[model samples]
Target chain A: MEVFIYGLARGSTLALMAVGFSFAYGVSRLPNFAHGAFYILAGFATWVFAQSLGLNYVLSIAISLVLLAAIGAAMYRFILIRVRGMEVSEIIASYALGVAILEALRCKFVGTGFSTPVFIEGTIKVAGVPIDLQRVVIIAGGVVVIGLIWAFTHYTRLGLSLRGIAQDERAALMLGIDSDRAATIALAIGSALAALAAVIILPVGSITVNEGYDVLISALAVCIIGGLGSWTGTILAAFILGFAGTLTATYIGTMWESVVVVAAIILVLLLKPSGLFGRQKEFEERV
Target chain B: MDILEVKDLMVFYENAIAINNVSIKCETGKVTGIFGSNSAGKSTLMYAISGIMMDMKRKEEMKGGERITVVGEMRLNGEDIMDIKPNDRARKGVVLCPERRRIFPESSVLENLKIGGYLASRSQAQETLKYVFTLFPALKDMKGKEGGFLSGGEQQMLAIGRALMAQPKLLLLDEPLLGLSPAMETRLAQAIKKINEQIGITILVAEQYARPILPVIDYGYVLENGGKVLEGTAQELIDNPDVKEAYFGV
Candidate 1:
């Protein structure tokens, strides 16, 4: 039961990260592999601000979110838009973003160990399980993040435009979407979400420059398992992955955990190519 | 006074003149039709006026990349709108319901309409929605449906509804009846008339089939091979022997 709570906490973070990635792909139609850079870089940034700079945890998180949002917007305007007309095989743009961020981080702080200030420095007992308060906070933050994202996509004008772009960008443009503007907005939000996840997860685990690749893989798995372009699917997949990982680690063995996940995902894919909750050409076909 | 005026406008595609020295005026609260054969620059002129086509003639001269040479002037409400951006033009009350009925395929019908009302205030957008729903009640029934699933005719109605949501002073419609059945075409035609007569929306339509459009337009221009072959009132073009021989196939 305690293990399940731990897994849920971790899965919430993964779900938030997946939502960010899904938004960009949903609206921009570009699978930005570089989004992992946001996770890794924000982790590094939070560590630096919290440990080296002696900034408070709250301040570091705020600065990280704002900085990442700005970086996302700049990357979209200066780079992504330029490579937009290029073929999808041009994953080079994302690679370029990753290289730039990694290089910049390395230059600023070389050979620094990863550490982040605790989000909450206490423990709580729930359902006969003792849980870290920070983990609970992380989980709560994930819930808030997902809720806000859902609302943003459903309720706001810019959100509607983003949804419109996700549907068909050229059509949105003819309807006057200002697509470049929409892209910038989406990138900013996506980056902010990634940064938030990074900060939330940092205190729970040590973050390293290379750890970004791992998070990237996890986010991709979550996104694919949930299905692309669907927010609700991403969240559900996150919890499923979380509990599954927990159950596997607790019952089976640690060695075969990742293997089990891979096999499970394959089985799910075979059964439903669009993911568990994804609609495969069935959403708008009725009309 | 003319709401939209295109004078000596020439659109080209790699040295081929799609629209050459074509000049026309769209009066307020009037329906004008540009009639032509398939390759006769009807869609080209509409594309030019809507700022969709690139003026390939002036590519090297301008600061922007691949300058589209627009030789003459396009004006709206006596203001030169040739230099303004397409979105800016739309905000300025000159909207186009393009030929393909470019509805955002994944968006709900209501969302599509709201996007068309991009320039309007929140309340104004709702009002526009009410107006469009009133004009095309079929769309109101499918408000939550994605546009891609709509039938060709329903999508055309949505396209026109979207343009009207912009509350344009001048609506430029390119082939609204394309691919639609005769009954659907008549339905759209009636909506176009209602927009003109009831709401007094000034409209310019470019169509290959003149029979459905001819009776409704106050004035018409006939284009052949990228140039205007004839221009007159709807009745004059209907009665003319040249028009009868070429267009009506009498």
Candidate 2:
């Protein structure tokens, strides 16, 4: 029961970290390598706003989210736009930006000493397992976010345009959807999502600059195992990895948790290069 | 008056000419056809007029792939649109039901229509949705099916219906009859005529096969090797021996 509850919470956290990455790739075909850096940046920004600048917690989170969204848009407008179609260049450019941001933060005052306060302080027992109220929030938040994303894509105009572009860019263009504008919106939304995940998850533990790389790795592993750009796949892969990590920590050792996640990714890639539900390249161009 | 006019248009990929000084006029509420064989620049002309060529050129340039040059004067409703973006062109009521029916394969038939109607007001979208269902009742049945799963003829119908949802003043159909049976071709040709007549939407259709399309077009241009070789009304084209031999297979 404990493993189940903890796995569920862990899976939700993984989903929160990876969904933005999958969404950005799905809409723009650009893998946002800086997703981890954005996550860490949001955590630090929120901390700076709330703790250092003496702003309200809710206001700090709101301001940091908006600022992260702008940074994401600028990242695309200035850097990613020039190298849009080249896959290698996109990966390189985004990864470079991510590394730069993370290393710069490390150079600054961000260290083991900084941590964000949790929204609520309480513990609840579900089936005799003591769980933090925030853990419950994480699981519920994940479902709500996924549901909202599904509804947005189905019912909203901008979301429909994003789906249209994702399927066939030129076709969307013929229909009057601007490709660059859609990509920019996608990047901004993706960054904001990263920030939201940070704000929610960072309160559980102290803010560490190295967690940026760990978050990126976790997100990449989940996305790769799930199938890049497949939201359902991301969720499924997250749960699989989440449970695997939890089970390994429970049985073998906590040191083997990261190993289990990485091993699953490698296994998935070796067995099915396109991941579980990834749209194959050959099928993409069918009329 | 012409709703769309292309005068002295030329397109080049690197140094090779794709469209050589081709000019065509589309009169309001009329069906204008351009017929050509493979590599005859029919698709290029359609792309140029719809402003997709500019996108292609930019993409190619960004990739350092090819040098594409387009020299043309495109006037839509007496307004010069040579420098406008493709989406802006679409907003100006010029929508392309692209070649090969590039409907969003992952999207359901209903969702595909909604995406096409991105530029329409709510009431306009609703009204057009009803009109599309009436025009192509087959699509009404498969409203929830993915576009990629539809049959060729059904996909063609969906493509046209989706374009109508855009509230286009001018609709460009690029090879709407490709890969369809003779019966399906004839049926689509009739539907094309109905759209032009019922909606009074000006159409510029480009096709390699002229037999089914030529009969329905009010005026047609025959393109050979990127240049306009012949042009006339349906009756005049049918009467010309060279046109008959080349296009009509008579």
Candidate 3:
């Protein structure tokens, strides 16, 4: 029961972390490897606002999300825009930028500790297993994000336009949905989502540069196992990885968590190269 | 009056010319046909008029790949629009029903139509959606079905219906009959005529097989190897020996 409860929390965290990355890739086809940077940066920014500047925590979160979104949009517009079609350059460029931001943050806060206050602070026993309210919040937050995204893509024009551009760029262009504009919106929204996840999860532990890299790894794993463009696949992959990690840690050893994640990625790759729901371009009907 | 006029348009990928000094015009409220065999620059010409070549050129440059050069004047309603972005041109009422029916495979038929109506106002989209359904009832029947699951004939009809949802003044259709049965081909050809006659939307259709299309076109141009080979009324093209033998396969 404890593993089950915690596994849900862990799975939701993974989903929140990767949803933005998956979404941006789906719409813009640009892999924002800087997703980790956005997450860590937002954490620090919120810390500074709420702790250092002594502002309202909620306001700090809102402001930090906006700033992160702007930064993300600028990154895509200036850097990723130049390498739109070259997949390797996009990966390298975004990853390098991510490393640069993280390293720069480390330089500033090396001697100091950064952490955000959780929205709620308490513990509750569920199924006789004590779970923190923060974990419940994380689970709830993840569900809300997923639901909002589903509604956004289904009911909103901008969301539909983004989905349209993602599906077929030429077809969307024919309908006056500009790919550049859509990509910019996607990057902004992607960054905001990453920040939202950061604010929710950073409360559980200290904000560390090490965790930024780990976040990136988790997101990549989720996206890869889910298939890059499949949202439902991302959620399912997150749960599978989360449960597997929790199970392995409980049964085998805590140290085997990372190993298990990597092994699962390799196994999935070997078994289903295009992912569970990913479109295998070579096999899909062209028309 | 001419709704679209391309004068001495030249397109090149690196050094290889895709469109070689081609000039064509589509009269307002009339169906103009551009016919050619495979590799005859028919698709290139369609892309050029719809302003998608600009996007292609931009993508190529961004990738540091082949240099795509498009030169010459293109006017939509007597205003020069040669260098505009594809989406902006679409906003200005030029839409392309791309070859091979590039409908959104993941989206349902209704969603596909809604995406096509991206530029229209809410009421306009609703009205056009109704019009589209009436024109292609199969699309209405498959409103809940994903586009990928549709048959080839149904896909082509959806493609045309999708284009109509865009509220276009000049519709550019590239190979609307590339892969379809004779019955479907004839039906789409008739639908194209109905769209022009009823809605009075100007159309420029490019196809390799000109048999069904030729019957509905007002004026036609024959393109061979990226250059214009012949230009005349539909009857005149039918009367021309080379066009009849090459396009009609008769």
Candidate 4:
């Protein structure tokens, strides 16, 4: 039961991470492979502001989110916008961003040692299992975040416009959805979610630039397993991967489990190229 | 007073000119038909007026000149609409249903209609949804179905219905009757007449199939090779032997 509780806690953080990837891809139609770099940067930024400076933990997180969102918006205007016209160019630019972010993070604080502050501290029991209070907080926070996003997309005009653009960009623009504004908003929201995930996960483990690739690969696998454009699919896929990974780790060595997990994802994609929940582009509109 | 006026509007694809110095006007409460052969810049003109062309310019390193403008010299009593944004243009009574029956493929039929009324309040949008459902009652049953699953005729209905949700003074429809059966065409034409006469909205329709549109259009412009070759009343153009040879080919 404790093992199950641990799996659920880890799944909550994975859900948060996958949600950002799915949300950004839905609205922007860009893979944003550099998203893991944003995850790493969020930890580094929060560490510098919140831990190093000893500022209020919440205030540092707020600063980290705003800073990362600005980075995302700037990248959109400068790099993404330039390459958006060419598919190959956009992918190449995204990888370039990833490399640059890794180098910048390495230069700043690898030696100084950066760590994110614990947002929720203590212990609690759930279903007769003793779980860290932070785990319960993570689960509750993930639910609230997901609920808020669903509400925002359904209830607000801007959110509706964003969803409209995701479905049909040109039509949305013709309807006056402001494709540029919608893209910016999606990027900002996606970046903030990534940051939140980093904060929640940090209490469980230390974060580092070298681990960036692991996060990227795991989040990407979750994205593909669930489907690239479906938010619900991403969260569900993350949970599936999390539980599956935990079960495999318990039975087998952790080293061999990653390979088995990836092979399973590959098998699923071979059967369904659009992922578990993604719709095939049959009759989809093209501009 | 003209609801929309385009003067010397030119659009180009890279180095090639798609539309050159094209100008036309639609007076209040009239259906103005733009008829053209394939590649005659009919759709290009529509894009320029509707602001779709403005977005294309950014990608091609092109810029819109000061010469081309939209919603000009029109008034509901005395307010100029040219100053309004494309979406706000709908609120101020100018709307475009668009060509190729651009329905939201993944959304429900009801959700598809709601897109047309993107600027309306929740209650207002819902009310407009009811009005549109009444016109195309086939949509009432399919509110939960994905738009892509609809038949071509039904998709066209949803498109027209979506545009009506905006409740505009001037509704611009591009190729509304394209890719449909003869029976469907007649039914759609009847639906359009009901919209104009009953709902009291002015319409401007562009078509390659001139026969179906000719019966309903008041004034017509015949375009050949991106230029206005002729302009006259529907009957006057029908009577002209030149129009018969070039357009009607009768």
Clashing pairs in 2: none
lDDT of 3 by residue, B1-250 (tens): 9999999999898899889999999999999999998999999998888888888888878777889898998999999998788899989999999988888999999999888888888999999998998888878888999988888888888888888888999999999987888898898999999999989999999989888899999999999989998999999999989777888777
Between candidates 2 and 3, the one scoring higher on lDDT is: 2
Predicted candidate 3 versus true structure: per-residue lDDT over A104-192, tens digit per residue: 99988874377899889899999899989999999999999999999999888898999999898888998899898999999999999
Off by over 4 Å in 2: A282-287
lDDT per residue (tens digit) for residues A188-262 in model 1: 888888888888877777776766777778888988888877777888888888888888888899887798778
Rank the candidate models, highest lDDT first.
Answer: 2, 3, 1, 4
Each candidate's lDDT (Cα)?
Answer: 0.80, 0.92, 0.91, 0.76
Stretches off by above 4 angstroms in model 3 are none
Error of 2 at B78 (Å): 1.9
Q: Write the residue-wise lDDT of candidate 2 on A142-252 in tens digits.
A: 898889899999999999999999889998998899999999999999999899999989998988889999999899998899888887898899999989989998999
TM-score, B chain alone, candidates in order: 0.93, 0.99, 0.98, 0.87
How far is A171's C-alpha from truth in model 4 (Å)?
A: 1.1
Query: Candidates ranked by TM-score, best first?
Result: 2, 3, 4, 1
When candidate 1 is compared with the true two-chain complex, its DockQ is: 0.26
Q: Please give, for residues A184-227, the per-residue lDDT of candidate 4 as tens digits.
A: 77877787778877877776667788777777888889989988
Residue clash pairs of candidate 1: B55-B68, B55-B69, B58-B69, B59-B67
* Tens digit per residue, CA lDDT, model 4, B101-175: 777777777666666667777797877788888888888988888888888888889888877876677888888
lDDT of 3 at A17: 97
